[model samples]
Target: MRHYFNDLPKTALTAGYWLFVAYLLLPLTLMMSMSFKDANFIAFPIQDWTLRWYAEVLQDRQFLDAIAYSAFIAFATTVCATVIGVWIALVVATEGIFGRAAIFALACLPAVVPGLINAISMRIFIRVIDLPTGTAAIILAHTVHAVPFVVIMALTRLRSMPKNLTDAARDLGADPFIAFVRVTIPYLMPALLGGMIFCVLTSIDDFVRTFFLGGYKPTLPMLIFAKVQGGMSPQINAMATIVLIATALIGLYAEYLTRRARK
Candidate 1:
């Protein structure tokens, strides 16, 4: 009786965790199932199953274009965010930097700002600067949103780095630039990889900022939003499933790389 009571809380917590997992995965599982449904409409029965929708989605020219455009934007955002983020992280991590806290806070501000508000502000800022809404504008917005994550990751890694590594590099007669490139950069690789992956994911998944800053060209999310306006269909589910799988794979691959880099 005593043992049973002692284990009760643990059992309950374990059960709750699985329930939460089920809650999250149930919708995704249902959506994936619908992608295979032969019927055009989304429904529960799903008596007929087929790959027609997936095939159609694959043949979709607009879908292809949107995905490609989104990819390009994500790539650009990741590069810009990574460069700027590393610089900020380095500056903040270095000793004797003035207002380090404020600099770090400002760099990370965009992440805490509400997405809609950020989007609205970005839209206005671009207009004020006479920057037209297009791929460049979208990339700029995404970079702002993504830079904070990189700063956080990189800064965390910098804080944990051993001081001797850089000291030893300097003692060996390596210049500051060479020490940073060869010693500091290698140490920061895991964090940089993780941050870059996060940036790519967030940029690709972004909708609000893209919606506000987009020109005539539509991203994948915009394409999906446009389709949803017409109504739900198996094709949309198929497209979503493909995206989910691709992103999941990318995340797993990144995890593997980070672990390897750490080793």
Candidate 2:
């Protein structure tokens, strides 16, 4: 009796963990399952399971265009965000140009601010500047949202980097730029890679901000939203499932690299 009572917390925790996972994954499972169902409309007790929906999605020109556009934006955002973030991290970690807290706060402000607010602000700013909205506008907005993630990751990694490596490079008569490229960047690469992954994911998944900032071009998420409003189709489910699988693969690869780096 005493053992049972003592084990109650463990039992509860185990049950809670499974329950939480179910809460998170059940919907995804349903979506994936539905995607395979041979039906024109989304329905449970799925009948005639087939890969027809996947085939349909693959042949969709508009969907393909959206995917390509989103990928381009995500790639651009990752590059710009990674560079800007590394610069901010370097400044905060090495130079005392601005107080660390102040710099960090400003860098992370986009994360704290609501997405809608960021979207509205960017829209207004672009309008004020008479900048035509399109891929460029979307890229800039995504970069703004993504930079904070890179800054946080890069800063954490930079804080732990051995200052002696950089100093040693300088001591060996290496110029600052060369020293940074040779000594510092290698050390920062793992964190920078993680930040790149995060930034890509953020840009790919973003909808609210992209909707406002993207002028004529539609991203994957925007495409999904439009299709969903027209009513759920198996093709949409297939596209979503494909995206989910891609995201999971990327996340797993990032995790593997991070663990490998630690070793």
Candidate 3:
């Protein structure tokens, strides 16, 4: 009785942790299972498991186009976001340019604001600037949304880096740019890769912002939203399942980089 009482907090914490995990995982499990069912509509106790929906999704031309466009946007957003984020992180971490807190807050404004608000603001900006609204616009909007997260991740990684490495390189007569490229970039790679993964995923999954900001062209998530407006199909489930698997793989890679960086 004494032992049980002494361990009560631990028992409660363990229970709470499992409950939290279940809350997150249960829906995903159900969705994946539903994706496998050979049914026209979504339901639990899925039966007649088959891959027909996946085959259909692959065969669908519009789905393929959406996937291609989404991939392009995600790749572009990752590049822009990571590059800009690393630059911002470097300045904020090292330079005290325009004051660190102000710079960081400016960098993070997109992330701090609600997605809908950011989308609306970008939409207005695009209209005001007379920018051709299409893939470029969507990519720019997504890049804006993704940069802050990358900056935060990069800044955290930068904090852990040896402060003297750049100084040592400079002492060895390396120019500032050369020192940054050689001494700083290698240390930042893992975090940059991690941030890129997240940025890519965010760009791919963003529907609300893309839907508002993207003109004419629809992303994969936007296409899914359009399709679901009519009715839910196993094909959508199949697409979602494929995306889920890809996300899991990328997440694993990110975890690997994070662990390797720690070493």
Among all windows of 10 consecutive residues in model 3, the one with the lowest summed lDDT is 94-103
lDDT rank order = 1, 2, 3
Q: What is the C-alpha lDDT of each candidate?
A: 0.96, 0.90, 0.89
lDDT (Cα) of model 2: 0.90
By the lDDT metric, which is better: model 1 or model 3?
Answer: 1
Q: Higher-TM-score candidate among 1 and 3? A: 1
lDDT of model 1 at position 224: 99
Collision pairs in model 2: none
Residue pairs in candidate 1 whose N, alpha carbon or C atoms collide under 3 angstroms: none
- Report the lDDT tens digits of candidate 3 across residue range 1-263: 78768999988899899999999999888888888898887886776999888899899999999999999999999999999999999989985467898989999999879989988888999999998778888999999999999999899989988889999999999999999999899888888888999998899889888888787878899899999898988888888889899888989989998888768
Residue range with the least summed lDDT across 10 consecutive positions in model 1: 38-47
Candidate 1 residue 74 C-alpha distance from true site, Å:
0.2
User: Where is model 2 more than 4 Å wrong at Cα?
Assistant: 1-5
TM-score of candidate 3 to 2 decimals: 0.92
Which residues of candidate 3, in runs, are more than 4 Å off? 1-6
